[model samples]
Target: MSAPLAAVPALTAPKAPKKLRSETVALDSGLTVVAVRKPGVPLVEARLRVPFLSAKAAHPARANLLAEALPTGAGGYDRAGLAAAVQALGGDISVSVDADRLAVSGNVLATNLRALLDLVAALLVEPAYARPEVATERARLVERLGMARARPGVVASEALARRMWGAHPYSLDLPDGDAVAAVTQAQLHATHRDLVRPAGATLVLVGDLPTARLVEQAGAALADWTGSPAARRVPALPASPGGPLLVLDRPGSVQTSVRYGAPAVPRSDPGFPALQLANLIFGGYFSSRWTENIREDKGYTYGPHSRVDHHTLGSTLALDVEVATEVTAPALLETHYELGRIATLPVTEAEVESVRQYAIGTLALSTATQAGLASTLSALAAFDLGLDWIAGQPKRLLATTVDEVSAAAARFFAPTAFTSVVVGDAATIAAPLAALGPVER
Candidate 1:
């Protein structure tokens, strides 16, 4: 009834990354600027990273509000006027904050690169956290945080963060809504003054301009944006003391959200390439073993994924999945089984080859565009890594062997290494899940 399947073609090894034309410069005000010349489109992309980590109890709420309002008004322009100015110069800019850093990112026509940098300098030197704008953004932030906290996935993630990091700033990924409501415009102004500065910050520029010229434009425009931020580096992430699973009761929930977290190596680590491939083969890709077992064979969840997330302070291997509430226990059992299997067993040569190609290919694809390269460079700058590190990744992946990947898997992917959280109807799933291991209610 059906024709025989055609033989799949063998995959070709990815070509080596071409050498990049780039330069790094330290400006007078203690800012680090990385400029790369990537020609294709007539656009330039810019990213600025300011170290924004803080352990103070009220810092998260203040930082969130500051990110929201920083670009809304700056220099002499109101929100609308600033938008108009950027549009006139064929550019756009936005600001975002996280536990590690405050980042400003945007793109502009290559011809307007200097103009966009000037606008960025305006935001840095003279952000107008005006009363009206702060009030508006604050109200909106509270509403968004409320909605996010209400979602099962967000709840599970927040719970996992707390369980893994304890009282660390990393535990406070989302600020409390009441804290946000209490923030004042003066507080946001103070936050900007205290944290948003040039020292220990990096600006990445990628576009059609010559690398040297891009650095010159950035330096010239940002000369007035001076001063070092206070010493606010986030402390080292605490080791995840993997213990009992946290089970939070969400009445009448039809689906269970399962989240797991464990500490992992940074990209600069020697074992990172091996761990990266092992992670992908385990659950990080569509055709991964966990996906095949849980989603394809058992139909427990639509998709189960694992990834290694890099932050300025540390890296974490995270697992996330959602399954029917009734199947929560079985889904978790299957997850644990997959983790144990990968950790204890030797990965096949074929498996290593497949994920190696995949890892190298994805790295190439992620940095192929002007905007993508700019963002990648900005993220890497946190660890003082640069284009050379990126260009050498393929060689690392290719050289990684089955034994090395298996070793990384055994070290990092042990089921007992993870601290997990499950959010669903506790009455229905608790006893079954406890049958597997200890669960804290």
Candidate 2:
């Protein structure tokens, strides 16, 4: 009863174009300011990055405590007063402490940028380091550390870091419950004086405001900020003590969490970009080998992937996935097989194009807002990269060849050096996984 219909061509949507440009200004005080000017936006985001944090300090948690404590009360304002002032001015301030850096950042309306900058400078240079606030925050951190220990994923990650880096400070677990309880206000103050030095730190400002004006304001705001001469040094990460499997037993787990990876290139490694692209093809995306093999084809887990954890001193290629307990071993095997495939087989031209498109397309999304642009610029400055680095990303990603990707995969993904971490019933899976490599209890 139906007439034959002619086949219609499929309509394809045009790819979205990329738009965004950034500029960087180097301040006289060794501070680097980066900014992006966008049309029709009247907001500015400024972030100040101090290079030393938990990893570089004599007492790491002290830096952690100070970051939280600084914003509570500074200059002549009490904790409540500071909060009210920021709220009334329609601005927000936050402090973040990570392994390699501590950042005090804020967002403000373009009209109120100067006041916000003044407030941030006071927090940094004129903090009273109120002992009462320090005691309160330290108590909260101790409680948080206790909660983290009960988390399976947290336990697995911290264990992996410890195993991978041994005694390196980077591997130091964030203060445990007992360690946090032992930290004192005096120690926090001493740690602040030692690591948060101007010579080793950099101030990064990113926003749409005039660069010259911001630099001038920063100079006046932070003029008296000085620190005792000291250089922070991190112990070298030992070569991955590659061996067998290590598993942490989370007895009641219905789903097994797995992390398998090995040491890879650092941020400064010349092969960083190539390795980054190569990883994108392997497991860095939703359509990558690990996803297709471990999830789609085998149905072992929801999804699986890998990332290059680019640290200041070193980096790692980490693959993580969650699967049913019964399928954990097979899923890990599939992960390793996928890793080897990129090196052993020639990658298809189609796959290369697909990944290149994905990488560049996603990057454009990352710079969509003023805050986003500022964050990107801050990262570039932290890595000592130039403004052109952003513009060159698309070209570099597209120019990678199959041969180059294969070589990069081979150089970075070594199955022998691959360390496996399974957070589930070690009693149930340990014997089977041990056959793959030596089993570390």
Candidate 3:
């Protein structure tokens, strides 16, 4: 008790630099393939990305149906046969339909890579889109819609997408129970024929496989797949018309869910890196401006952050925060203030450095795994970026000047263009929020 002890400073280790190994293969069929052969893992992941999806196709919903229907039966095998084959090989295949693309992916042991590729080839080249399976899946989608409506978060997100995109086909809602009920087997087949094609698709494989063998196997498996002339370019979305704050009333919500943002740059935009850095300083990290001001300082809620969603249709910056219902207006006001501050003020050198380090370090950590590497390539393919984008990242990130960050903030973080979405008791916070902008009650 009589002796005073000096405190020891905690040791912080420096982050290790990232090593990225990747190769891009261009197939004679015009399918671009990207692969990453990392050591220490015995598993391989293959991702096939097609740029055409529900939004661009004649019947957008069919894109999703066709993607789902493919793995159910292909290469003369029924749904059960395909399932048994994958299970026996100790592998799994899944499909996802996004606004800009459709992805079919599989993970298998290294030894079974050839078999997995054969399975994927059959799925892509020989889907039956059977009527019975289409009806069953349609019923399942109807159930999913019903379940989605019951979740406040899902409802808010769906509503936000609709409000942001307006009449754009991308805004096409996930079909509701009634809409699902209306979908027919013939419609599914017709959509499949229109959207899933060779001209607008990419194939990616990542794992510890020889490049030569992979190319040979993939070529033979996918050679028969054919389609019409690919679309020269992706459709553009109109600027999000900035307007009133939209508040969806969800009764008994203990926490007020918020989504506030507007259109931002696409992945291919020159300002992409700068905007990414600027957004990190704003709310992309745990210790960002939004978190420091809105949560740490005021104790408004648990956390807040923002992201740039790069999609085939377009891109947008999203600021998401959840707070107690009573403090919703204050939280929103603080968020807007922080956004405006980034543009108007010159960020301190320390803040700028911190964000850059955080972003670069995260990138390194993300590409450390085979699956992670494949995912990175898939995103690049979707954005039409080159294979060298990863290698070129350091120069671009380090080259970001404070002035560029400020300019990016000014260009993309305009508060006037932001659309506010709150899922809470509209009766409680509606009036207070309207004073800041028009209210879409």
Candidate 4:
């Protein structure tokens, strides 16, 4: 005879987040600095966020080159000399850019915090953009972009963005290789002058130090780097009209990539917490219904995920999955089945409680370290959010009712609301997929 297994334990609610001491200051030069005293290791983290969005068609290539060239040489040092200076301070630095902003982020020894600030100031105010350095980065960027476009996932993402945002700047996730090759050092210098100024930007510092002293150090270092970027309006996100599935051809691909998207609420919306929880229950986690059905039960994919992607202009609910080409049609069929089920039926109390605990626990874990906290705060700075919003999220999650989660699921998870795309061997997938719905070639 075999013994019966014991019942699983019930989950307890998450505790309130710990309060940390922090300060914010706006300097006369139009920069916002936020400092937080989180004593753990003997290190500090820094993030500089500058608004980089533009309506110009040429902005993407110039912005890409400028981000790559920022740390190559600045002030009096070349690339190697700049690296040596930062390494001598027990630090590391890197630059990155996207559709919305350009960010320079790194960490350093707590005692050398002021020195790191000085280096950042130099990079912002006096970048050299040497001819040789810019030429090398431009070639490398072109090659990298060529390689990226060859992948199936990149092709599908580009198609989805085009369908979702139409002619908006958001549609162009990666710039054209020809445009990147055409960028000149002079153009990059002009881009730096126009978009990389300190005005309408923010700096975040977190580590073992008094908040007030950290703000003063930053203020003194960045005082001279001041100017407003050229004014350009970000057009509102166009409505993502749901229609026939768009089938893009990638000849001889063994796997099929499926992308589906719908409109979603931002973090500031009153219904955001419930919507977040609902997404987790649907496909945001490994234990979610969509994953359980498509991956575990049907063996269609290794995993599938859904999430709320936030942008400055709007937010979207996105779902992504890659399955074997032979199973493409069946996979999408099961996906629609699951979406329809969740949107029409009320979720159980157990499901809601499970996701709530997961959400709160993950948030607490993400902010437990200094680097993590610095990055989190910097991303939130785009929306004018700070530590107060982070500390108060657990309470909001605890108070959310099962009814709220169900309502949110019904509203956001409806299958009819999605704009879907599939990238695979059109010869094999087109007919079967067309049987499910109207598919545009």
Candidate 5:
């Protein structure tokens, strides 16, 4: 039998959500804490970000090594012992490292938040970079580095960073092989002491719990944690470290990987929302013009993407695409065409609304889960922002006009502003690329 039709309700624009109430506290030990009370769920999610600035350090890969070895054991617990303990608590924790920080994140029953937190304290305070463990991790890192060197994407990305940052530590993503081999247990220990300090670091927690309870427990658990301040100084970037095409020559390669980007505004900028929407309308999503032009029409690549990546010091708008070597030049030309069009032409209100809704929907979905909200809050804290900053995103994006999107596009998305690199068979694509513009060997 056919179901009876229900009352049809007319659609309307979504109203502003109730403000999210969150607390930010600077602990006496200098660790920052951002806590939001989400009461529906019974799980607690937490993240710890300790900035890793290895520019002046002896071994830039030491943090990377620590990320692997930390999980083996700490504070009188072996690998098996630690795993058993976490399992007993009905919780799990993991560690990872990036250009900026080492992230220690985990989830647990809301009632067991304090227990998991204590384990975290132990791991960070007395991380066991034991010799045997370090050697095993070093072997793994070496193997991974060798594999990354062979991958065209990694090769091109590393080359671009080296050209942009010069001798800055940031330029080196995978540590030099010799440097990785040279990292000693003592060095790892010292690096942790100097860089893993609570000062300027953040600890974010989100879940169903009283704000006061979570704050008090966190303060007590991390009370004894202390160390030297993390080094965080913005490096002096070149006036223009982009433009010339650097090719990562891979002989006999069947495809070329294209990377395009330049330094751009940070998230806190007033024009950020509009710029973000502009990126979306251009290539940040599947429905973007860049994707439609290159993937749907021209059949140049499987997917093309662009994003604004942020760090402690600066931000960048990066675009990436991979196409067959035969079509590399044509693909590059079309990409430029799309960039020029976006920068020069005004976007329609319909396009603006589509991107705005997508942006808002994404933000809402990101904070819909306890773990998601925790990580989101943690990333925001790195920029000295809180929930309020994210709470108003829908409004900011909604208020943005098509003209504003066009202005942002012109200012930041101009094709000429980009410095690009292509990784593929230079012998095949070099001539075509040179015809388009200057090509550096």
Candidate 6:
């Protein structure tokens, strides 16, 4: 009395919404402002990206201290004063820096949008990196870094970054504690002076508002500020330490965290759509073949997922899984097995459609929420893109043929193309992993 799974009606992607009323305004200070009106929620989300680059002596810790200390005091207000002022306007704010740029984001009721803009713009104009406050934030950051480094998942991803990026600033996983402790308020000020500038920044506002008014508000708040020139370039990435097995020794550990990845393309690449679907079918979802084979069948990991991640500097196809220390090698073997199958086999149309629906449905859901739309648009701004491009994504996925997904899978999903590192008790699992392939001590 039930229809066969194959006989089930195929899933359809949601219709693309009409493009938002949008405009780009170039402020006098050289910051590019993108505004879009969605007009649903009585709320507004604002995202600011100020360019932050690494120096010859790269110190992520120093940059982080600068990021953390900004809100403690800015625009003639102490840290608590800033928090109180922002909260008074029904808003919250956060700041962080990566190899590419420094990000500042916050949300507020639509009625308080101007107040939020004023506070953020003021910080940009005159950040108070006071000496005592810098010391306070520095100590707390160092303590948190120690706890983060102890987790195997963190350990493995940091290892992946190191193996993926050699000598480039991207390779530094966490900031050095001693380096952090040595960071002075003068350094934070210096970093801000050299980096955070309006000319090198992009600000995005999305929610219920007029695009022109949004731009006007942004310009008024930031008009007097100045930033460095816009000619800065990200250091070109070096070649990945090619497909090799790296084993990191973590003594007396109960589980192994394995991270595998390969260089991939960015959002601008034409192949991005097919590659995204290929990733979905591989391990981007719980029902993906990689998950069905390893997590559901073999019970090697509770969470096994993959993604095609894009950063300003580059992109990668990466997946991670955790398994019992004793089964570390087995888990890696199965991961490769699934990867090989996706590369060589003729995938069923049904499999392709299933992933297609999930991908499209997720995009719709993510953009439906105000917070999600703001985050999505802000992330796109990092790549010099905007909302129209994202609105067309469901079409691109729909246009992907079975043959195309199959070809993409073969081209990008091959197991042999990956470089990986296993983090666990080297004494217990090193020999077994070594027997499987080349294992670095």
Error of 5 at 271 (Å): 0.8
Error of 6 at 372 (Å): 1.3
lDDT of 6 by residue, 232-325 (tens): 4557887666566888988999999999888888988888888888899899998999898878898888889899877778898999888999
Report the poorest 10 consecutive residues by lDDT, candidate 1: 228-237
Clashing pairs in 3: 54-60
lDDT of 2 at 169: 72
Q: Compared with the true structure, what per-residue lDDT tens digits does model 1 show for residues 140-205? A: 999999999999999999999999999999998899999999999999888888888999899999
lDDT of 4 at 275: 97
What would the per-residue lDDT of candidate 5 be over residues 200-274, giving only the tens digit for each residue? 889998888877788888998888789766555646655447767887788999999888877778888999999
The model with the greater TM-score, 4 or 5, is 4
- Provide the global lDDT of candidate 5 against the true structure: 0.85
Q: Write candidate 4's Cα lDDT for 377-409 as tens digits.
A: 999999999898898788888889999998998
Deviation in Å, model 3, residue 434 alpha carbon: 2.2
Per-model TM-score, in order, reads 0.98, 0.91, 0.90, 0.98, 0.95, 0.95
Note the Cα lDDT for every prediction shown. Answer: 0.93, 0.73, 0.76, 0.92, 0.85, 0.84
- In model 5, the Cα lDDT at residue 88 comes to 94
Q: Rank the candidates by lDDT, best first.
A: 1, 4, 5, 6, 3, 2
Task: Provide the global lDDT of candidate 6 against the true structure.
Answer: 0.84
Off-target runs (Cα >4 Å) in candidate 3 are: 1-23, 54-58, 229-235
Global Cα lDDT for candidate 4: 0.92
Candidate 4 off by > 4 Å: 1-8
Any runs in candidate 5 off by more than 4 Å, and if so which? 1-11, 230-234
As a TM-score, model 6 comes out at 0.95
Over 4 Å off, model 6: 1-9, 229-234
TM-score-superior candidate, 4 or 6: 4
